[model samples]
Every structure is written in C-alpha cells, then in structure tokens.
Target chain A: MKKFMNTAETMVAESVDGFVRAHADFVVFGTDRQCVRRRHLTPGKVAVISGGGAGHEPMHIGFVGQGMLDAACVGHVFTSPTPGQIIGAIEEADNGAGCLLIVKNYDGDIMNFEMAMEMAAGRHAVEMVIVSDDIETARIGEGRGRRGVAGTLIVEKIVGAAAEQGRPLAELKLLGDGLNGRIRSMGVALTGVTVPHTQRSTFTLGATEIEMGVGIHGEPGHSRQPFSTADDIVRYLCETISRDIDVQPGTKALLFINGLGGTPPAELYLAFNAARRFMEERSIPVERSLVGTYVTSLDMQGLSATLALLTKEEMTLWDAPVATGALRW
Target chain B: MKKFMNTAETMVAESVDGFVRAHADFVVFGTDRQCVRRRHLTPGKVAVISGGGAGHEPMHIGFVGQGMLDAACVGHVFTSPTPGQIIGAIEEADNGAGCLLIVKNYDGDIMNFEMAMEMAAGRHAVEMVIVSDDIETARIGEGRGRRGVAGTLIVEKIVGAAAEQGRPLAELKLLGDGLNGRIRSMGVALTGVTVPHTQRSTFTLGATEIEMGVGIHGEPGHSRQPFSTADDIVRYLCETISRDIDVQPGTKALLFINGLGGTPPAELYLAFNAARRFMEERSIPVERSLVGTYVTSLDMQGLSATLALLTKEEMTLWDAPVATGALRW
Candidate 1:
C-alpha cells in the first residue's frame, strides 16, 4: 500500500483538519473538531446533517455548506463515527427550526446515529432519513436491508434544497424517504481498495476479473465476472439499475455516473455515454446527467451508475442552487 | 491495462462525445467534433481557445464554458492536436474581437498551433500565449525550456476572465505571458501512466520507489527516491518550488494541489495540509487554495503541486465567477 500518508492512525484526522483549512471560508470545525459545519448557519431553517466513514470523501463532509448539509460528523476510515461526534454535529447545526439526519443504511451507522439522536433529544428536534438505494444488497436478502451508495448525493441534494427553502422537518423527511424509493444504483470494481491501516485489500481478484454490484467499503459484490469492454460493463450496470427501479418507457431520469476513486474523468464520461445509449434505446430519456468521483472507496479502481426516476418537482429541486466544497453552482 | 474504454481507437472520441453530451447546456462540439466550444458565444469578446492531448481532462475541455475558455480542441490521448483541429477551434470560437490561443509549451503543440495561426492569419486576428511553468525541467537547463504542467489552469483562468471582460487579443496574450512567469509546478508519480492503445505502463517502479518532477505524460522526472511519508514528499515539493521561484517571505500565493489520477481526495487533502504548513513556516502566506484532480495523466497514481505568486489584481481575477464543467464558483 503505497499511499501518500504519514501514519494510518493520524491520516483521517489530518485530512479533516486539512479540509477545514482548505475551505475555511465555507466551513468550520465544530465542538472540539468532532464535526465540520457550515460557517454561517441559516436561522429558522431546518438544518440538514449527515455522517459516515471517511473513505467516501466529498460526501458527508464535502456536502457541508450553503443549501446542503449544515454539518458532517466524520469518522475514521471505513469506521462509523462515534455517537459523541454525531451529537456534536447536531448541537452545532440545529437552529430555531430543528435538525434532520440523512444517513446511509449501514448497521454501525444506523446504531451510532440513533444513539446520538437519543442523546440530543432534549436539546433539539431531530429526525432521521435512512437511505438504502443499492439494489443488489436488497436482492441478496441480507435481512439488514440495502446499503446506500452513490445515490446518497441525489437524496442529499434534493432534501438539502427543500431544507434550504425552510420546509418543515416532517416534510423534508418525507421528501427524503420518497427519493430513496425512486433512486437505484449499482457499482463495479476493477480493483479492490486497500485500507490504509491494514495496508491490505479487503479482497483480491484475478487479472481478468471484475466485481459487479460492489459496496462502497470494498465489500464483496454479487458476482465476479471476466473483464469485458467498457460498453458491456456499462450496459450491465445500467440494465441492472433500470430493471431494479422498473423504469418505464417515456420516463425521464437523472443519470448519474460516478467514479469510485482511481478512475479518470475520461473513462467516467465514456461510461456515461454508454449508459446514455442504453437509456435512449429503452426510450427512457436521461433528463439530467452528473459524472465525477464524488463518493469513493479509498483508491478503488471502479465506477457506479445511478438512475433516479425524476418527477417534475424533483427535477426542480435537483436543479436548485447549491454551494459546497465538492459541489457548487 | 484495466481501463473502462471501448477500444483504443475510439476511446478519446467517445469520451469527447460523452463530455459534450453531459455538458450540452454549456458546450457544443465544433466543426466535425474537432473541438468543444461554449454553447452560447458572447459576441465582441476576445475568445480564449486552448487545445492539447486528450488524457489530461477537466483542463482544456472542462474549462470550456462561461467566464473561462471559449473552446478547446481535443486530440487523441497523449497526442498533439492536428493543425486542422486547432483551426476548427479558432473558427468556432472567434467573434468580432478576435481570438487568443493559450498553448502549453510542447514541441508538437507549439508547431501545430503556429501552423494553424499561419493558415488562419487572413481570416482572424490571433495571438498566442505559450506557457512553460514547470520548474524542474528549467532547473535541468534543457534547451527546449520547461514543460507546462498544472499551472496552465492558472493562465487559462486569469486570461479567460480577462477575455470575458472584452480584452483585445494582444492584451490577453500579454497577460497570459506574464502569468506564465509567475507560476511554477512540479509533480511526483508513484506509478507510471498506461496508454489505452499500448495497454502497458510507460515506466515501471519498484514497490518502494517513486518518481519526482514527473511529467503529465508519464515522462521521466528529476529523481527516483524511496517511498516517503506524505509530509516529507510535500515538503520536498514545496521547498523546491519556493527555491526555484524565489518566493519572498512576505509574498502571497495561490497554492494548488492537483491529483494526477488515481489518488483519492483524502490523500490529496492530507498533502494540502502539509503544503500549507510548509508555507506557514516560511512566512509566505497562501492567500488561496485549490485542490482536486483537474489536470490528470490517465490512471497515473500520483499528484502535482503548483504555486502562483498572487497580486491583488490577479486575486480578483481568480475570484471572478467561473462556471465550467469541472470548475464553478
């Protein structure tokens, strides 16, 4: 594991410190650096907060800014944040209205966030929206439900826009839950991720193999297949996602092709074109498109395809203004 | 060898098609898809045109939008654009105010762009800005001069903003030439880049080896050293740049930490923190910071650092609004 880092113990902490410094004008360290929060909080607006492991960068933390997440509780790489950290974020972000937690569906994350919600019950009105959009996990019947992946950004953006509009906490929660139903995503990994601390990949594959429907933390996917051309790989991803959502003909979607670290922008765009072609053949037009490395699994050479069935109103929300470290318009 | 591409011959073209489609609202293909140009042209403004090989994305093409580049001619991966392609860009971008061509200092690029200028001489008033800001190649005293690296973005951004303000061709060229002198950059590669056609790395390194001052095309660098910690590597990069540019103790700079490709955001931020500390120790304050994988060598696992001495006027230009595919503010 030839990573540009000092010691694995201090890597995540140093990265958090550096992130705050790099975007100081937009964000600040909150409560002994337990969380990163927007520098300027909006009064009487429902505060939106999110938290997770550190490897999937530009996610919870990068989303902390105007018109998006109010605060992000960061954790050690591939580990869930402590309840104290989540509580600190809640304390720093809650304004007169309340706070809403947009959480991915993971056992550790759900448990810690729930513990933090209970801890902060007396001080702030807190509601939670758990996102479980990875369709493969649901099909696998893990009994723990699906694990959220790249589609979290869609949920965050839409709910964040609604929050910025001063929507009631209940309404925002409902909107977030509704989005989870419409968004479906699946990912493929060409190379496994090596955890910084362990200095070892969670799994390994043969030279001509690829993993389909992999989770964000380098977890095993549904199957391993022979390495194929870009068009075939992308066709599989788009077909699986669209099939999972039962997207109908003439339906419009926001096709988001995301790189899961290590994949260059050229390949990401190439994958986007393949996915676009797939949708066009099905008569399912992709009304909006986003392609980049947003959520990542540390140095994993892979990409994910997400399709969100767009309603006219949801389209307006996704198009709404957002200013954050990783996202701005 | 493991890349998401359809075929070597079609990879760059497909990527360009995908990029134009993804950003249709902001850009369009020009003249048989030889270039990507702004969708809405601003008449009478000096058109800022740039072009180069395809691999380093979010640079020439991603910069084509409002308040930045007017057009970007693209060539095959790691190959210079032909004179015909450059001429197409000039034709598509130029409005009444003429055009400014920002060319990176490469032998092929310089020759082709000059040939294009000669071919289009009678049609439009054109001026050129040749950027050669990589300090390592200069220190080596090669007769060909330094290679332009990540600092080209600084030249494009400042000159692009000036062109957007209706600066004439000559003035924009002069401004871009001035910027080239103030900016310096150097990169390190942990692994060599693999071209899609070849399906083999340009160079190989031992498990504990790393290359310093590596070029964007995976060309040989100044030295190959044992793998070091992030802090030490960043220290070497910052110290080398400061010494080359003779950055005064009280000077201000825009510290840009760019990922070549494959390096994740967490590691990038960690490197940024080390650089910020290095400048702080020298009393040369970093007035602004930009970090991301903007200019990249396809799947090269490494990063580059760039420093541009900032004037109050240049600071304002840098702060001006820019809405592009990869950059927005």
Candidate 2:
C-alpha cells in the first residue's frame, strides 16, 4: 500500500500540472488547486466535455480533441470534479455551437454535472448527456442508478462524432439518447486498486473469488462469485448485457472488452474470445470490436464488456475520423 | 493476486474473441486461435498493423481501426505474437496497397514481425518500421535496442494516418521512422504487475521504491530509487527524454503522460502538470499533450512520459482523424 508522491493533498494538483505541461497543445486553464481545460477550442464545432473522479485515465481528459470532447473538468482522485470546474470547461469550450456535457451516471457526477449544466444554461446554451450503461441488475432496485462504466467511451465516441459533424445541441442529445439505449456494459473485478491517497486497496476479494459487475471507483459489484474460466466470465458478462439489451443475430454491434486498470491485455483478449464465441454460437454478427483498456480503474485487476448496438448509421459515425490522446481514429 | 480466468492458457485468445463480438462492425478475424483482422478495412488504403505481447493492453489491439492500425496481432499473454499471426494479420489487411508493420523495439516483437515481413514479402509487398522510443539511457549501451514503450502509440497514430491518406508503403515507413526518431519515452513503476499465467508479479519493487525506465512486460528498470514526488519523477523522465532529443521552447511537441497499468489518472495529471511546468520553465513549447493509459503493463502502478517532437508534417499526421477501440482521434 505504498505510493510515489509527496503528500496526499498535493497529489491531484501535481497530477494536473504534469498533465498540462506534457500536453502544451491543449489550452489548459484552472487554478493549480482545481479542474482545468485545454485551450484549443473548436471554434464552430459543438464542444464535448466530460469529467469525474481521477482514477479513470484517458477518460475525461484523454478524450479531448477533434471528433471527441473539447474540454474535460478534472476532479480529485476518486472524487467528482467540482461544479465550478465543469462550468469553467463549459465556458472555455463554448463557442456559437454550444456544448455537450457527457457525464457518467454516478451519483456525485450526475449531481455535480447537473448543477453545472443548470448554472451554465443561465448564460450559455449548454446541453448534457448522462451515460448509465453499467448492466449490473442488482443495482436496478436500489435506485442508486446504474453506474456508468467502460461504456461511457462509446457514448463519447458516438456523440462526439455527431457533435463534430455539426449536429445541433438538440439533435446531438437525441443521438446520445439513442446510443445509450443501444449500449450496455458489465464488469468483473478480480482484485481492488489501492487509491494513492488512501494507500490501501479500495476493495477486497478472496483469491478464489471475483466480484461480478463492480463499479470503477472500487465499489463492490452485485455479488462475489466463485472465480471461473475466462469463458465463463465472458458468458456471465455477455448474458447480463444481452439480457439488458437484446443483442440478436444479424445486429451490428460494437464490443469493447475493457480492462479495469490492472488486468493484462492477454487476459482481456481471453475474455474477449469467450464473448466472441458466445455471439458466434448465436449467429450474432459483430460489426466492430475493441479489446483493451479503454476506460480503466487505477490498477484494479478486472475487465468490463461494453456492447454498443449499432445501426448502419451508428456504424458510419463510428467510422468518422477522430484525433484525441487515447483514440486517434 | 486474484484473477478472472478458469485457465491461464486460454486467457489471451478468449479476450480477443470477446473484443470481436463486442464490436462486430469492425471486421474481425482470428477468433480461431490465430491472428485477427478488422472487417472495416478500406479497399484501397494501405493497411497499418502492429502487435506484440499481451500485457501491453490497447497498444496493438485497441489501436486497430480506420485511421490507425488496420489489424493487430495478439501474442500469448506477455509473449510476442507468433510469426504466423503477424503474417495472417498482414495478409488479411493487405489490399493491393502494401501493408506497414509497426513493430515495437522488443527482441521478441522485432524477431517475430521481421519473420512475418519476410514471409509476407513473398506474396504481398510488405514494409516494416521498428519503433525504439524508450529513453532508458541504461539500454543505450546494451546494443540490444531501446524497448518501445508508450511512444509506440505515436508511431502507430502518425503512420496509421499516413497509411489512411493512401501514402505509399515506403513513405509510410519513412514517416514511421521520423516519428520514432522524434518520440522518446521513459517510465517509473511503483509496483510490478503479475502475468496471470505466471501468477506472480513480473518483477519486484520495494514498498518505498520506484523502478525508473521499466519496460511494458514488467522488466526491471535502470534502477530502483526512493519514492519521490510526482514533480521529481516527471523531471527525471522529461530530462531523460529531452537529452535524447533537442526540445527547445516554441518547438511544438506531443507530450504523453501514460500510465503503466495501475497508476491513477489523478497521479498522471499531477505528473503531467509537473512536466508542463518544467518545460515551461525551459521554454519548451508543447504542441499537443496526452495523458492516459495508452500502452500499459497489466495493472503495474507506474507512469511513463512520451515526447513526440512535431514537425509541420508530423503535426498534420498527428492531428489526422483516427478510429480505433481505445483511441478515437
């Protein structure tokens, strides 16, 4: 449970500074103590922005660029980026085309981004899209809300492409809604990630156990299940996502087998293989597939499967060009 | 170390299958214990393909798409993909426009991809570019070669864009070479990651030690030093990269603050900020900056920084639209 840092308090600020310095092409702004933005504003393009706790790398920030998000509000490690920060990002990315806030469906994120959206609407035309693609059925009853996991990236990519294509704010919102309906994600955590500030693993499981459907911020998943083969894990995840969104044969789908930080590419590929088999067995057609760590949870050892049901149009949008730190195409 | 797998041997293959199932829009091959291709391959564009060990998630596979890699070969977990796999990828992606193989400068990756290149050259014209961006000064004298780390992403993006633009294979090779020369990377690992098959951390580090210039496979770095502040770490990494290339103020550079698997984004941003400040103090002009888990070690708690020195042409290529699983732009 050790970390490489001077003090817990300075960790977030220090990280932000280093990020801006390394990415000078981005017009970065914000106090050394708070959230920041990239300066390269897409003049007429509808700006896309997102932010949340800091554990998910390449997420809110890595996504900023042409054909993606224009700005990302930074939050503390595992904490929501403040409303003020979101407001600043909105203002900075805002041009005549307005802005889109892609907030993950976490309680804190939803609350903060919602408040920021309200505040910004007073001065600018600000629109928002909440991604709630986590398909853990256990959370359906608590009303805690379906946690936004790896599927957030798909939402960003799809909606970001639409925004880049000059879709109006209202139309973009509809597109976001449409994409969300077509997407679902489920995850399994083998071990917990130690948050640097806490210097302790965020959650714990037995060496023989896997926490099915865990959220990114070290939240316990629906249940702790006996560890199984990569194939079994894929079955569990695919079944969950498919049940949530009826993925039928001949349906064009985008599969994302995402690493939850610490899982190796090999393990992710294994999980992905099982998922592909599951689809093939059912004669379902996989139009596009991505396997790797897109959205991550620090170094937690786990993987999440995100299914984006694609129409021909969505597939075309997925093919649109993009330039971002994490995603280039 | 808990893991989500029934057997160690099947991990990589399963993950690859799941990846294709999840994104069916992209044409996928190799679900049958072999190399794979994306179906979205343009008919006339020169295909870009890259691959290596399985631990480096998103490096080879996540980068496969429209403007990036046309296909990716996934090796066994933590092992290089076989020559047959590489050849398969090349053949699947080849479309009259010769294919470019972007191989990272690893002994295994180099040897395998080289063999594949030779095999493919007999039938389809194949060109290769070796990326050696690791700025680990320690490896300079080894004569073995500098291990390609996160900087491979830059090579892939630039070259992928060039290929997408229908550049000749020779021109793409030169572009890849130019990017390799301009890009430099160095990393520090807080903790080692365990390869699932091995069931042990790839390497060992102390509770209060950071391994500087660690490789993606969890190889031991140049030295284990006392854990320091993010600023100090950034300085060490940046100075190492800067020494390898002349990065002056007003020179636009693409800075990448990449996570080595387990490092949190918060910490990455802190490191990014420090790097930015250091460069600002020195008047180094950073044109574009990226912070995220691009090329990663399975949940290794560390970060790496890559500086892609941008010329006008390189910058244009860098800004080109790319479509992939992990990277959008």
Candidate 3:
C-alpha cells in the first residue's frame, strides 16, 4: 500500500508531534507525550477528555480546543492507549470542575479508560460516558452490543459544548450518554484500510463489491454487497437508520455525512443530497447538516451516514461555536 | 471506479446544490444556476470572484463566503466554466466598488475568464489576478510558465481579506498578483485520479513508483521517481521549492501542507513534520502553518506542499477570520 509514513514504530508518535506543532496555538502536548490537551484550558469548566486509536483522526485530536475536547490521549494506529496515558490526560486537563471521559464502545478502549478512572478515583471526580451508535452492531446484539462510529462526533460536539457552558461532570456524562441513544451511524466500505504496521489491507473485496456497516478499525461489516449507485447506497443507509430507530413523521434530525478518508468532498456532498432527499420523503425535517471528512478510517475508501434525532436544546448545542484543527465554525 | 456519484452529467449540479444547501448560512446560489455567491454580500466591498473545473472542490466554491470569494462559477469536471457562466457570476457579485477575478493559471480558465472580463466591460469595473505558483512548471520554463495549484488558496485568502478591508479592484488585483510571486508549491502523486465522467483514472503509476510535481488536474509532472519515505519525499519537495525561489536563511514562511483528496490527516501531519524539520535545518522559520486538505485533486492519493514567504501584514491577513464551508476560524 502506498502511504506517506516513516517506520511503523515511529509513525504515530511522529504524526502526533507534527499535529501538535501544526496547531500549536490551539493545542499542546501534555506531560505525557501521547496526550494532547488544549493550549488554553478553561478553569472551573468540566474537562471533557476523549481518545482511542490514532488512525481515526480529527475525531479526538482535531476536537481538542475551545468548545470541544479538553484533552485527547492518542494511541498507536488502530490500537488503544494504555491506562497510564489516559490518566496523564485526565490529570492535565482536570481543573477544579472535575473530568468526563467520553469513550467509544470498543473492547480495548473501554477497559483502558475504565482503569484510568479507577486509578484516579480519590484525586478527581470522574464520570465516564460510553458511546455506542453503530446501528449494524446493535442489530447483532451479541458482544459489546454496539460499536461507536461517526455518530461519536455528534456526541463529542454536543457534549463539548455543554462542558464549555460549565456543566458538571455528571451532567456532561448524562448529556453524552443521552446523545448516544439519539445518534445512529452506518458505513459502507469500497476499499479496506492498510494498517501502518502490517503495510497490508485488513480485508479485500471484488472490484464491484462493497462492505456495508463496516467498523472504523477495519472490522468486518454486516455483509458484502454489490456496488451500487450513490443514491441507492445512501438510501439503504438512511432506511436502515430509520428502521433501527422508530422515527415518527416530522422528527427533526441532524444529518451528518462523513467521508472515510479516501472519498472526495464532491462524493460526500452527493451522499448528503441523497440523504437529504430520503429524509424529505419520509417527512423528516433535517434542521442541521454536516458533510465532510471529520471522522476517518486511515485512508479507507468509503463514507458513513449519521442521523442524530435532535431536540431543540441538542440542536442549539450542536450549533454552538467550536474551533479545532479539523472542525471550526 | 467505485465513486459515490449518480451520473457524470448530474454530479456537478447535484453536488453544487448540496453544497449550497449545506452551507446555506454562508452561501447561496446566484440567479445563474452555476454560480454560487455569498448569502450576505457587502454592497460596497470589492467583490472577489473565482471559478474553475469542479474537481478541486472547497477551493472556489468553499471559499465563497465572508472574507473570501463573493461568488464562484463552477464548471464540469476537469473542464473550465463557460464564458457565459463567468459573466453571470461577475454580474451577480459585482457592486458599486467593482469585482476582481482570481483565475488559476490554466489555458482554458485564462481564456474563458478573459472572455468574460471583456463581455462585462462597461457594465462592471473588472480586474483579474492570474496565479502560477507551481515550482515544477516554472523550472520547465515552457507553455504556461507555471500552473497554479494549492497556492491559489493563499492568494484568495490574502486578497479576500484585503477586499473585506475595502481595497479597490485594482489594489486587490495587485495584492493577489504579488502574493503569487511569494508563493511556491509542488505536489507528488501516489495514485491517479478517476474522473466521474470517464469512470477511468487519468493516469497510472507502477506500484513502487510515484509522480513528482503532478498538477491538480492530473497533468504530467517533472518526472516519475522511485517511491521513498515521507521525510525524503517532503525534503525533496522543500528543497525544490526553496531552490525555485531564492529563499533566504532568515525568511519567515507559511508552510501549507495540503492533501490531494485521498491522503488522510495522519500522513499529512507526518509530511508537515518533515517539512518543518527541513525548514528548521535551513534556519528558515515557519511563522505559520496550515495543514489539511484545503486544495484537492479529487480522490488522488497524493499531497502538495506550499511555501509562502509571509510579511507581518500578510500574516495578519492570513490569520483574518474566515467563515466558509470548508475553512473557518
């Protein structure tokens, strides 16, 4: 696979270092090298920290700044950070207001962040919010129930905004956990991801085949299907989301179309248009929309559709100002 | 070939419609369907207008908001917009102050924009700035001298800020033209781009080979070279740009690393780190840095590095607040 990287052992560290330098005005490395925290933290405000593998960028790292994540504990590509790294971020980001950990529903991620919280028990008041918004994984209902995907962005954004408003740790956790139930995401992979360490694609498909409901870490999706037109694919995704969540008529939604690294903006917009049309046909009004590569899968060729049923308050939070490397408004 | 598009004929229009809708708060469609203009235009401010083929998105279209282009006349994929469309955008964006066109250095774009300027001769005072910052094309010293690439964003951003400050048409033109000379850019392609219309890649390279100095429209570059590490590739790019223009040891530069659509944030930052090291070793300071996929070539697995020697004033202008779909701060 063709990629711009150094040795696999050093790729993540180099990338994290480069990222901090590029946005030095907005973020800084925590005492722990793997942890990145906001350059200017707001004291007395709930410090919201989130992280996972390094490959899904602009997700955790790009969200670190005012009105978003206070700190992000970056890990090796597609690998979870250790508990020590998580606690380092927690210690650095927490002011007097306490800390909230937003963890995606993943085996390694949950275990590590949980350990970090237990380790920091006496010193800090910590609350954890686990996001599980992947509809396909929910359908399986076996191990881990559901895996978080692009909808995690919505949770981060809304929760981060709330944290900036001086919300307490418990409130922030409730806000994030509430958002998880409202958000549903599903992705289709046209091509697999090549891990930096392996230098090989996690999976392969025929030229005209696609994997629907793929996980971010290159996990096998729901099933392989014949590649179809953009409208058809988006229609299927929208339908699945609507079916998973019993959407009544006239429900307001925040339709988010996320490119999985390799898809271009034009195609993302096409998917957005398709999703918008589908919502319209179902009498669902999309009050807010975000389309771009905010959450990604390490240069994987695909796109994900996220629908967050939003209340008026949630919509206000989503519309709140956020300034970060990947997202700003 | 696995692109998320409906059909080539409808792709641009659909995408444009989706874009305007997504950024409804920032931009709107002009009377002419192909033209996208700022939703709230400053009546007396010099209207800055730009356009090109569709593939390089978030360039002309995404720049159509406050502190940037007033309007963008979008064209078909890898094809220049018609003179009629250009005139339409000009008429829609122009106010009492006048209009300035930011045209990239391409034969079709130049010819069509020139024709549009003549067509709108007595109606609106019009001036054009041609940007050609490609170091590779300049070194060749043939044809169009140099072709504009990622550096066009710098010109638009700086000139757009100047226009917002009530610079006249002629002054804006001069500012944009002057910035072009200070900017130098070079790109490397790891994979070719597939046009939506053709459903075929424009070019192909061997697995272990890469194209250096490739153009935004997938044009042939200086030469194909053996694939190398990120540092080596970025070091070569920085050296070429530094040589093309006699970069002084103490010169302060704005190092911009742009993804060519498909490259992910991790790789881009790795490139940024390498470029930063190269500048540091040369004793040239990077006063500012912007790394992401601002300018793109439509799902081509590649990236470009742009170096703009910035003065204090230009740095201020670069940091000016911009609220657009793709870029905002």
Candidate 4:
C-alpha cells in the first residue's frame, strides 16, 4: 500500500505539525511535539485527556479541541506514548481543577498511562479511566473485561460535557466508568492496515473473507468467515454487542457506527441503517446515534458498532454541543 | 482495495439508502431516489441545488441540509444522473422563490442539467451556474474553460447562504458564477479509485509516480511525474496554480485543502501547512481557509488544493454558518 507520508519515523511528528497548522485557532503544541493542548484552556474546569496509538488519526488528536479532551498525548503508530510525553500533557492541561486521563483498554496504554500518572501524582491530582467496552473477549461470569474500541468517543464526549460544567474529578471518573460499562462494541475488518514506513499491511484477508470482532489495531478476531453483505455484517456486529452486553428490550441506547479508516461514509451509513433496522426489530429504542470515522486504524477497511445504553443525564450530556475538529454538533 | 458494498451496480442506491437513514432528521428522499431535499422549507426562500457523479460522497449529498443546498440529485459513481432525476429534484426543492442549478464543468453534467432546466421551464423559474474553477488546464488566451473541482463547495456555500437570505434566482446565479470565477483548483492522484461493483481501480500509477493536475473523476492531469515529499507536492501544486492563474503577490485568498477520500485529516493538514508556507513565501495573504475531506472521489488517495480570491461579500457569505452533514461549522 502506497502512502503520501515522507517516512514512517517522521509520520507522527509531521502529522502533529500539520494538525497544529490546520487548527491553530483552537489548539497549540504542548511541551513536546507528541503532545497537544487546547489554545485557550478554560479556567477552573476539570481537564479531560485521552490518547493511544497514532494509526487512529481522529481518535485522540482530532478529539483534542473545544468541549472534548483538553490535551492528547500522541504516540507513534500502533505504539503507546511514553510516560514523559503523558506527563507533558498533564502538566500543560491542568488548570487547578484536577486532570482525568482517559485510556483505551490496551495493555501498553494502561501500563504507560499509569506510569505517567504515578510520575504526576505528587505534582497534581490525576485520575484514570480505562475503557474496556469491546465485547469480543467477553467473559462476564469469570469477570474478564472487554477491550476498548470506538466507544471511547462516547466517554470522551459525555465526560467532556460534565467536565465543562466543572464536575469534580471523582464524579467525572464515576460517570466515565459507568458510561464505559454500559457501552459494548464489536468490529469487523475487511482488510489489514499498512503502517507508514513499512508500506505493508500488518495482516491480510483474502479477497472473499472477513474478520469479525477484530481489534482496532488488526488484532485477531473471534472468527474468520467468508465475506458477507454490509447489512449482514452490521447485524452480526450489533447482535454480538447486544447479546454479550445483554441489552434488554425497550432499552434506549446510542448507536455509534464507526468507520475503520478505509471504509467510506456511505458504507458506514449502510451499516448504520442495517443496525437501526436490527435494533428496531428487536424492540430496542435508539435514543441517539452517530455515524462517521471517529476511531480508525489507518486505512483498514472495516466498521465497528458500539451501543451505549445512556441514562437520562447521560443523554443530556451527550447532546451538549461539542466543537472538536473531528466531531461538531 | 476491498469495499463493503454489496455490488458496484447498486452502490449508488445503497449509499443513498444509508445517507437518508443517517440523516433522517434534516433531509428526506425527493420524489426519486437520486434526489434528496431538506425536510423543512421556508416556502418563499430561493432553493439552492447541486449535484454530479456520486463518488464525491459529501460533495452534493452530504451538503444537503440547513444553511446549504436544499436538494441534491445524486448520479452514479463517476457517471451523470439522468435529466429526469435532476428535474425531480428541481421540482421538489422549489419553494416558489425559484431554483438554481449548480453544474460542474463536465459535459454530461452540463447537458443533463440544461435539459432538466428546459423540462422545468414553465413550471418554475430555473437558472444554472457552471463552475469552471479547476486551473489544471488553464489556457486563458485560447478561450478554453477549466474543469470544476473542489471549488464547487465554495460556490455552493456562498450561494447557499445568499439563497437562505431570500436572494432571487438571477442574483444567486451571478454570485455563484462570480465566486466560481475567483476560485482555482488542481489535484493530484496518488492512487486511482476503485468504483463499486467492478472491484477494480480506474487506473494505476507506479510506486514512485503521481498524476498531477488530475480532475475529480480520475481524469488525467498535466502529467505523470515522480512522487515527491508532501512539502514539494504542495509547493508544486501551489506554484502551478499560481503560475497559470496569475495570483498577484499580496492578494488575499481563501485556501481550501481537500482530501480525495482515503487521505486522513492529519495528512490534509500536512498538505495545508505546506500550502500555507508556499503562499506565505510568495507574500500572498491567506484571509481564510478550510481543510477537510469536503469533496472526495470515492476512496482515492490524493488531494486537491484550491484557492479562491474572494470579495468582501463573498467572504461574509463564506464565513456564514452551514449545518450540512459533512461540512457543519
């Protein structure tokens, strides 16, 4: 797979440089090039922070703007950001109201973000919320957790709104954890992602094959099956989440149909339509929904379906206007 | 390039299905499936409409919403919509204030839209504005016209704002044409798009080669040249447009850096940063700018740079708020 990047090593730095240039109005470079913080930090507000690997272009970087993350500690593609980088964001984004670190449930992310929090513990009040909303590895009886996927956006937006209202750190953490618990996601990859410098996809799916319950980084999924229609894929993904999370009838949830980079908006919509119809048939009340490329893994041809059962308060917070670079409403 | 679509033949229909499903709140299907109109109508406001081939996901359809186009007649991928389909949109979008047809410079589009205008001659007042802002084929002295590319978005946004303010058909057309005249675009093709159903890319380039000055629909550009760094590409594109369009030093212009699908936001920003640097080096004032995947060619991996010299009124209109699915700000 060919790309327009100059080299794999400089892809992240150049991307961050470009991000600042594009959104110079609302964002600025942090202490390091790997970190970016809001241009005008709101005083006395709980600072929200989120980050992970780099392949997911809009996940942490695009979400770092008004009404969302105060800062994002950008790591290399499919590689975790270092503790020093995370510390830079924490130090820059803190405005006297404690900082909240939103971490996806990846081993490297958890370990790195935790180490960074420990480093910043004495300097400032810091908290962490690990989002393991993916149901692909569900083991509810044994108390095993799911991995995080596109559902991070939901936590980001809701927690962001609450933080904007000056919610305490503990409350925001509780809200974030509760939201994460209620959310379940499952994704299918039609193709593998090619890292920048490598010019090679991490994995490969045959012309007529698909991988269900795949991770954002092309992690092995529950099963590999022959390719199916978009409608079928959406239904299967929604079914997996709905069944694993035990979504009850009459439950009002928000449907997040996310594109995995290579997938276009039209395909996402088609998948969303299928998901909506599936939910409707099952008598699940869809309170709200979003369809776009929120969380991506480079240019992988795939889609993830995340259903978050929102409380009344959560719904209100989710509806709050957000002015981020990737998502605005 | 694997896709999630069921078939190429039904790609347009399925995409429209997904579009309507995702945007059921603000838009609805026009009489025909290819045509889409806003759910709410002001009854006496001038109706703005635009369309072309369907592969440009957000161009015509994603733009159908409040503060933008009232209706869009979607054609097949890289193919023109029938005059009958366009006429349906014209009739449905008219709120008794008249309708404006924004046709790109493609011959099929021009002919179809013209025929549609003739079909709606007596029933409603109709006019058309042809956008030939692509400077890739600049031949001013030969009386040759350029092709329309991403610059159409500027025309649509500006004209849509004026129409929202109850501007008449003739005035809206004139404003649209004038804006189109001031805009110039040139795109490069890094990878050809694979239209749905066929499952084959339109064209291919060697690993180290690129098609410069390409049109939106896979049309060949100035020449195929060796690929270069992002900065070099940006400088070359800006220089080509500058040399051909004769952009005077110190002139204020709006820079629109568009991604032709597949390209990430960070990459678009990277390209934008390079573009801004090029303009700065030449002492050209960038009054305003927009960077996004507003206009795309399916899943093509390339970008287009468009610079529009604006008037004071045009600047105001360009800054006006628009609430479209793909371009809301």
- On lDDT, the leading prediction is 1
Predicted candidate 4 versus true structure: per-residue lDDT over A1-329, tens digit per residue: 55656667887787777777777888898864658888999999989998888888778878887777999988888888998899888888899998999998877888899998999988889999989888885532224357778999999999999999889999999999888888999889998777776777777889888988888886768888888887778778888788867565544689889888777676677677788889889878787888888788887878899999888888999888788778887
lDDT of 1 at B99: 88
Determine the iRMS, in angstroms, of model 3.
0.9
Tens-digit lDDT track for model 1 on B205-308? 99999999898987878899999999999999999998888665444699999999888888899999999999899877888999899999999999999999
Candidate with best DockQ? 1
Winner by TM-score between candidate 4 and candidate 3: 3
lDDT of each: 0.90, 0.76, 0.88, 0.83
- Estimate the overall C-alpha local distance difference test score of candidate 3: 0.88
Off by over 4 Å in 4: A137-145, A248-251, B137-144, B248-251
User: Which ranges of candidate 3 are over 4 A from the true structure?
Assistant: A139-142, A248-251, B139-142, B248-251
For candidate 4, what is the lDDT? 0.83
Question: Model 2, residue A226: what's the lDDT?
Answer: 89
- Order of models, best TM-score first: 1, 3, 4, 2
DockQ of each: 0.84, 0.43, 0.82, 0.55
Report the error of model 3 at residue B108, Å: 0.6
